[model samples]
Every structure is written in structure tokens, then in C-alpha cells.
Target: MTLPAVPPISFQDIATELRLLPGEGLSFSWDNVKRLLGMSRLHPGPISLSDFLGKTRPWWGLVPVRSNDIVGTTWYSWNQSDGGLAAAVDPYFGNMPITAIMSTVSASGSDSIINFQSDPGFRNNIKAQLLDDNYNVVREVVLTYNAQAGVQWRSATLGGGDTSTCLFIATGIFTINLIKL
Candidate 1:
């Protein structure tokens, strides 16, 4: 006997797995939402911003870019023409000189303090950071790597608001970080 065809999952079902970077006025799913109420034991209350944000860790790392139209707390537009990270999958923040991308696995030691070195010749552009939930920039640090050499970048564990997912967002390009140990 022939087996019946399976229905494709709708976008809504899978959409929960996806989340908009914080601060972009986008919606997100609460994994804790269902689990909190005990699955079927009791009806869950609306996840108040306070409850959800009660105590969380800053999510640090890179996430997928939904659109070239999203312009984070940066000077350049989504379609960064000149100063932006180039198109590259293996590693983000590619060929584009000033664009940002998630940092790729490298020989460089992890846990090494991430610092942002600025190019004085061109202009002053700060690399901003944001939380994973709202993509809201919590802090702005100037890109300065004058005295300090090697790969330049400023580093910090995403704080402010909730700290559940401490993902990092950058202005120059997307950068993924990891602890060396």
C-alpha cells in the first residue's frame, strides 16, 4: 500500500525557532513560555517583560541575517555599499572593509580580550553591541586599537535588560566570539 503524503509545516510553526535580533521591533518566541506552566498541568500566564527578563545571561555570538534591509544601531544602511562586511558564509564580516560579520573559528586564542581597533584615516565609526532578544544596543564603545596591536576589537558580555541569550551585535561587521579554554 502507498503511504499518505505528509503535510508541510507552516511558517508559523517553524517561525518560533527563529527570533528577531533584539531592538529591531520584532517578535520572538519564549521557549520558557510553555515549559514554565508545566506543559499541561496549568495554564501559563502572559510572560511579562519582567518575568521573562527577570534573570538572564547575555547571549554572545552571531545569528542569521533575515534581511539586507535591517540597519542596526549603525551608520551604514542594510545594503552597505562601501563600509560593510562582504558576502561570505563560512565566516561572516568578510571582504567588506567596514561591514560586520560573525567571527569565524581561528587560530587566535579565545578568551583573548576582544577589542575594536578603529581606522583613523577614514572616519570615526563605533562598533555597537546588542542583545539577542530585542537587538537593542545596550552599549557603544569606540573602536580604538592604537597602542594595542594584533586583531583589534572591544569585548564585553551583553548586559542590560535580560541576559538569557548574550548574543553580540556589531556595527563594523558581525563577530562571533568564544572562550579559549
Candidate 2:
């Protein structure tokens, strides 16, 4: 089955560019959390998943922030009992696409690994997996996001080919850095 072109990893929203804290903190914020929360209220009634995901605001605003970090997913749950802060990321990205082009001959050998960028405490069992165009899980490799050694490596091989592209999805709030390897 052909999936719709996965909407460009939404990075903008309806919020005016004028700084919410105008004249200060002048930086492009990546805040999908705040944008998705108000989905139902904005669209109302029934809507297709694609339609909802496709909604583009004049611009999106930041989710609640704390100590200078974007916080909480619109759907997942977490906790910060002291100040009661919680965060989750889009599950859609969990199923983000990967392609053969994401492979490097180095990671293809037994001694090398795929590099998945991560911080020390945020990830557990972080990984990289190969998928076919149909989204079937073809192969998976558990990544060790070792910040101490500055290494984020996972071992997985999808043989060799180049006629098509698949996904090299990571296990967290994925950043878009599609490149041929």
C-alpha cells in the first residue's frame, strides 16, 4: 500500500514570527507539542488522520517550556513530580521512513555501526531499523547512544541495493537529516 507523502516533519505553526517574548529568545523554535494539542478544537467534528496531520497553521507556537527546553508531547505521558512537567513526542516519527541510501559501507561491516545522535539520559534501547517501501520491518539494530565516548552506533545490514529508498528511523523525537551514505 502506498502511504501518503509523510507530511514534511512539521516545523512551523500559526504563531506570528514576532517573539512571544519579543526582543528576547529570538530563535526558531521547534514546537510540535503545542500545535497538535489544539487539533480537535480547531478542526472540530470528524477529520481524516491525513487531513489533521496536514493542517498547517499560519505558524505553530512552542509547547510549555521549562528551564529553556521544549516540553511534553500532545499525546504521550511523562512526569516531573516536583514541578509536574511531562513530555512526549510524535509516535508517527517512530514509524518514520528509511532508505538504503542511509547506509554506510562502514556500518555494513560486522565491526561498524549506524550512528544515532542522542544525549546521555534521554534514550534507552535507542536503535536504527531498515524497512521496505511497504513499511515492513526488514531488519533492526539496537543502537548504543554512548555520549561518554561520543559514539552512537547500531549494527544492522540490509544487504545492498540502490534502485529505491526506505527509512532509517530512530527511536525518539527524530530529527530530519536525510542523506545518502
Candidate 3:
């Protein structure tokens, strides 16, 4: 005899494995949310006024823009036209954490490559770092903004172990994107 068909599991049910509920927001104190996404809570940063404030909420969005469309301490507009980053504001000032639903694997994972970006002509020394759930430094790299260099992005690789058991956190100025390839 054939067995009956199975219904697809709901998002809430799936969250249970991560110890989450249907309406739970990710936190720097939890694992499930961090595991599912590479979101990390940033420390408070300094407050400043700049043109970056007008930027949209999502890093990659382009429509119906509003200042309140804000996403945390960072002014990340969902839309983006330049590759500088999704958020234009200096996240360091807010001392806030950058959070995202990160990707992962059970074992034998590739390296975690982080990319940093900035204006081509600004002279600055940016301190950037990547961390794991235990708050361990996985990798660290600095991005120098020298209009001459036009080095919009500086990338460094870290961690090749199984990601199934840890959460990776990205911190610093510019945009912090974690990727494994």
C-alpha cells in the first residue's frame, strides 16, 4: 500500500527547530535567528548629521523612498544604485549591530569572505572584523579610502569549518557582507 501525501511544513514549524516563534525578531542574544541569518547586534555608534541620512532603508531598493523606511541604527535603503553598500551611513557611529539571515552548511564549508566598501576619494581608516556566535574573531581586514586607489571594496576570507554549529557576525564601517564560495 502507498502512504498518504504529506503537507508542507509551515514557517512557524520550521522556526521551532531554531527555537523561534512566528513573530520573533532576530537578536544578538539568540542562535536560531542568527543561524538562519547572519544578523548580529551592533554596539552603539556616535551620532552625526550627513547626507547619508536621505538614503533609503534597504540596501537594494528603488521606489517609494521614505526617511522612516529606516532599518535599525543604519540608514539602509532597500534600493541601491551604486555598489558602495546597501546602507550609506557609517554604522560605527550607531554602535548598532548588522543583522541578516545568514547562509550555512552542515560540514566542510568554504571560507567566509567579507567585503568592505567606501567612497573612492574619502581618506579614512576603517576597522572591520568578522565574528562567530562565541564572539570569536574569524577574520579582520581594514579598508582605506584613497580616492586614488578607487578601492571601493576590500575583502578577506575566514573560517572553512562546518557552519552548522556557529553564527557568524560582521562588524565595522562600510557594508559587511558574508559569503562562502
The model with the greatest lDDT is: 3
In order of appearance, the predictions have TM-scores of 0.22, 0.26, 0.24
Q: With candidate 3 superimposed using the best TM-score fit, by how many Å does residue 126's alpha carbon deviate from the native?
A: 1.7
The TM-score leader among the candidates is 2
lDDT by residue (tens digit), candidate 3, 1-181: 1111244433343344344456874333443333223334332323222212222111211122212212222121222333333343322323122222122222233222112333323334444334544333454444333344353323222245433222222222222322211
lDDT of 2 by residue, 69-167 (tens): 123211111112222211222222232211111323322222123232232233344343343332233544454434554534333334343212222
User: Which stretches of model 1 miss by more than 4 angstroms?
Assistant: 1-125, 147-151, 154-181
lDDT, candidate 1, 117-161, per-residue tens: 333232222343433333334433433232454444433323243
- Alpha carbon RMSD to native, model 1: 17.6
How does model 2 score by TM-score? 0.26
Instruction: Rank all candidate structures by their TM-score, best first, as comma-separated numbers.
Output: 2, 3, 1
Residue 136 of model 1, lDDT score: 36
Clashes of each: 42, 14, 34
Question: By the TM-score metric, which is better: model 1 or model 2?
Answer: 2
Q: What are the Cα lDDT values of the candidates?
A: 0.29, 0.28, 0.30
True-vs-predicted CA distance for residue 169, candidate 3, Å: 14
